[model samples]
Target: MAKSLLFIPDISGFTKFVQTTEVAHSQHVIAELLEVLIEANTEELQLAEVEGDALFFYREGELLSQEKLLAQIENMFTAFTGHLKLLEKNRICPCKACATAPKLELKIVAHCGDIEFLEVQGNRKPFGKQVIEAHRLLKNSVESDNYVLISKELSSDIELPIYYYSKVFRFKQGKDTYDQKEVEYIYSIIDSNKLNISEYSKAKEVVFDKPPGIVFDRNFAIPAESLLEYITNLSYRHLWVHGVDKFEYTENEVTRLGSEHICVINNKHLNFVAVKKKVKPGKYVYGEMTRSIPIADTLYQFYTISPISENSCSLKIELYWETKSILKKLLITLFAKKVLMKNTKTGLDLLFKLTEDSRSIPSSK
Candidate 1:
């Protein structure tokens, strides 16, 4: 006997989507959507086979990290919706399937239990009651078309974030009278919108008392939306930001207006503190270096992005410093400007590289 994690990501509204839509084009859309889902599979997960409208994936060994699994699920959802949007935009056929395919939704059901693999004709297939239970869970009582339901048994083994709220459901098994213990299952509705897969904070337009001390601009070969996600989403931001030591988010933070973070940066073994200003999504992000005993409130940074083409965009950043101090203003003009330009250029190049790599993935359009 082996204990393993069993999960299925099932597509909802798929039957209706295909039935009324053009068969040839609808099949292409389904195949494209499934390919995107399969690409999200990590090395930790072993994919068994593709069921009609869902993919069967499992990981045998220790319990998988809930956070990583949750991220993968969210990533797949983003990809799914993104490609669907492309299909909708580029559709030429006035068929029902192409028109309604964007309405398809996804849900995941996960569980952990004893499992055994049976080899028939050299193909590996999972079998046992636990496997059946995992499949049965797909036909759940969840009202939402989009959700992730982890069995209460597996949920207990791993601690989910505080944001996830769960509900109890008593599923009647084919009119069989049984105790509540047999039918009772607790699951959580994954609020995809609440999850900050790609978020940034900003107002309509950032205002400064005067002109910035330094500015840098460059074009990137990625869409503004992808660049926005890279900049706004802290999870993705940390991967590329240089000298990031740690970050402290505001209480129950999810990257919105009035949300703040104390970003600690390591500069040649010395730690400096910077505070993120309130961010409005899709506009701009501003931050300032906080005053320590030795550091002054002089340094500030602002970011703004604009679209260039269907697959490209322009990024602009301005660094400002207090010019009230005559001596400090002279010092920055003579020396600091060069250094700021070099560092800002390097960071933007790295950002461009990251966004370009992100766009390399296969998309519907």
Candidate 2:
């Protein structure tokens, strides 16, 4: 029988990341990275399972050529690190989970051997001693969290050298014993700077020559980070902001600069894009812009949260609008401004009530 391939790409430091950071945001970050890795699968490798922080994959009755295997590893690594860079550059949340997400790393393990199969709950999966060995290889002495490890059997089958050296990879032989059986492998510590990471959209920082037309300031008894999450997370939009029929956004995605959402009000769609502007130090700011309002050519709303104490913060909401039509300006000044100010005050009142109620409940963490 021909030998089959076993592959696993594990997120290094995941346990520590989850344990040391905010749980909800950490989960979202890990989920996003896993999705990125899955999208980077160019070889059509069959996914067997998602083992918590790792993905179990297999290619039956075949081992990829040395070039193809190396390319696959590099592709996943590049995608993973590219996303980390994107998170770092576009982050808006001040929570520890979002702030430290760039520190996460990835490691992949590859092995080849004769395979067997097992059926569990109508799902067929790879089974046998080779599968165990492949998982065991993940615990080897690789000395680095970011690396690619190929078993001796796989290296021999693919004709990969023992001492391979490249700009991105510097491979060396290593061995470790599991169950009193010695297992040999070659690992290369990946240099993130050496990989050609794909580009991502940077945050769009806007500048306005004129001051905001309307501004409202309020104090909240919640941390700045918590208040920012309540404002930026679209899930909490309809609860506090009234008159919105529905909010449309990616449910599982973390809100970051350049993220977009649609607000359905009175059957009209208002498209908004997350944006940013310069703010003072020690302040967390989130801004959104839209041109979908009929009365104005452009509208921008910014929420700046400044920490007053460990458990208290001040929120300032600024509204800016522009229009070239004299009639539109007249409408904004006479009718639109009053309506917007009313809505803003109502929303802040509702948010403050919600935060007060939340404080009574004990934290799950």
Candidate 3:
């Protein structure tokens, strides 16, 4: 039983923020906040889960000291508020101004509690009342300026100062009213360098952890929508050939290139593996090639991939029914893919050189 402690910050009414503005209007603000969250999580925390409005952070079981929790929440609040100010200065959202917008004030609640980690079906499942109660304390608190609250259960467990706020209110809960008591915290400026997760999410830096499988998502730098018009009239097929006949694809039928077959070849602990799909216009697909490998259930094809770069992309070649009986299992395993690691790098290295100016798609005549 490995003991545990966690911090969960629930940004109030998150669904309304993104939904309130138009896609064109909210794009920059949303991007900025996302950047801040990613930056903060990458810089400060070990980075757990990023749900819609809530975030979960996990620390080493032994490192759950009161001082650390205070520092974590303080830094997060600092970053969150600072970014909020930047958004206000740019007139991103009139409602996010803390002085003027009461509804947009962020509520942060922190706590430490006991938990036992167990291995269930070869998966780690950590459960306890600590997290549930702490979550309740957060939801129970009213929104205020840096209004952070903690429960007595948490205050008793960890050594920290608690600002008492006894003015209690009742919240509607399925026709029942419940106690909404809270204990606040006095936060200071967050020192970014002291954060534990800051190094993991550098925008330009790539970290190699010998990933569970390969991930090839180059479309971030080169999109398929832009490339569609370029390939529309071209009759040439790009063949990602491997373990096949050569004269079968002849010159007039295709423009062949040597590219990496491994767009994204990684495994999730050798249990859950995924491949990203990049769908192009006029490309043939018997199935959704957006993020799928056709007929990949039972047999594993050793991937041959082209070198990946920032602005290059790969193509998806068609899969055939040559071995029908053996491919049944692959069909079943195709739907649960979590990441879409496309095979563009393989295409870039094999077909055309991706120069700096080669990023744009050709316009249709």
Candidate 4:
């Protein structure tokens, strides 16, 4: 896997989008438009076709080293914009679909030095290391018509010296029963990796439904207060290791429940820290990875406690990426899905086992 990669999500149902609008076959036009954009982008970014509408790009073999890398990404985006201008929409006949449907948007995320190849093939190119995390970042991006958001890592490395401007927006997708996460979005799809078939396979298995939620009503009785705090605090500490550490709550929830909620924050490194800023958490929060994370599918969450009366405290959590598989769920007999199931079960066990040591302490305070 390449340490860094770029991601671009094109609209999937262009034909449907065109039917309601004045445009005739807007999808065709959009396809051609993107093809032209990529033509110019390839050389400008020093990128090679990875597959689909994504690519692997870097400045030769030399390390990006922050400032130089930022310049290259900005230049790539600038070239991309220039390509769009050359293929000016005004030059083409404005069809109903083009007029009605929102202008095409690209949510871009860029990162560096995290590349790896899961598989090697004679004809097929390899995947970059940052594919999973990069895509996760891309999904969290706000869908601006044409915007760019850099990761904290990228932001630190690249100065982004360009006439263009980029703003950081926190993104959360899915609501209600679905989980949401804080993310940054951008218009330029400048990460080092593009869409990969293997990634899609792994991603398709994500189970989006029945995630841990914003409000939890867990009840485990007859546990000692210190042990309870020990488990809760220990889990809280674990969540800080990976991103997704924002939290909010109204009342206690564990065994006894509480009167109000408490919010906890984490620093950039995912270490527990004070939340100087305030933000509400989603309803479906992902649970944390206490032990080793699952290999099949994975999700994460974080909760905080106020410790009022040492009885119960409120919990707030943020959901991380999720994986589900309709086919995998149905194909139990298939050897592949079976292996996936086993790994998933093992992953869940590892997560739960982290709390086993604290179980003897009795009522978790």
User: Would you estimate the TM-scores of all the predictions?
Assistant: 0.48, 0.95, 0.39, 0.34
List ranges where model 3 is wrong by over 4 Å. Answer: 1-3, 23-31, 41-44, 90-103, 116-125, 143-145, 164-365
State the lDDT of candidate 1 residue by residue for 155-186, as single tens digits: 66777543464222212111111223353344
Q: Give per-residue CA lDDT, model 3, range 62-119, as digits (tens).
A: 4356655555555565566665543333221122221232234455555556765566
The residue-level lDDT of candidate 2 at 92 comes to 90
List where candidate 2 sits over 4 angstroms from the true fold.
Answer: 360-365
Look at candidate 3 and tell me the lDDT of residue 198: 29
List the lowest-lDDT window of 10 residues for candidate 4.
Answer: 196-205
Q: Give the local distance difference test score of model 3.
A: 0.39
Candidate of highest TM-score? 2
Separate clash counts for every candidate: 6, 0, 38, 63
Structure candidate 2, residue pairs in collision:
none
Q: How far is candidate 3 from the true structure (C-alpha RMSD, Å)?
A: 18.1
Cα displacement (angstroms), candidate 1, residue 297, comes to 53
Best by lDDT: 2
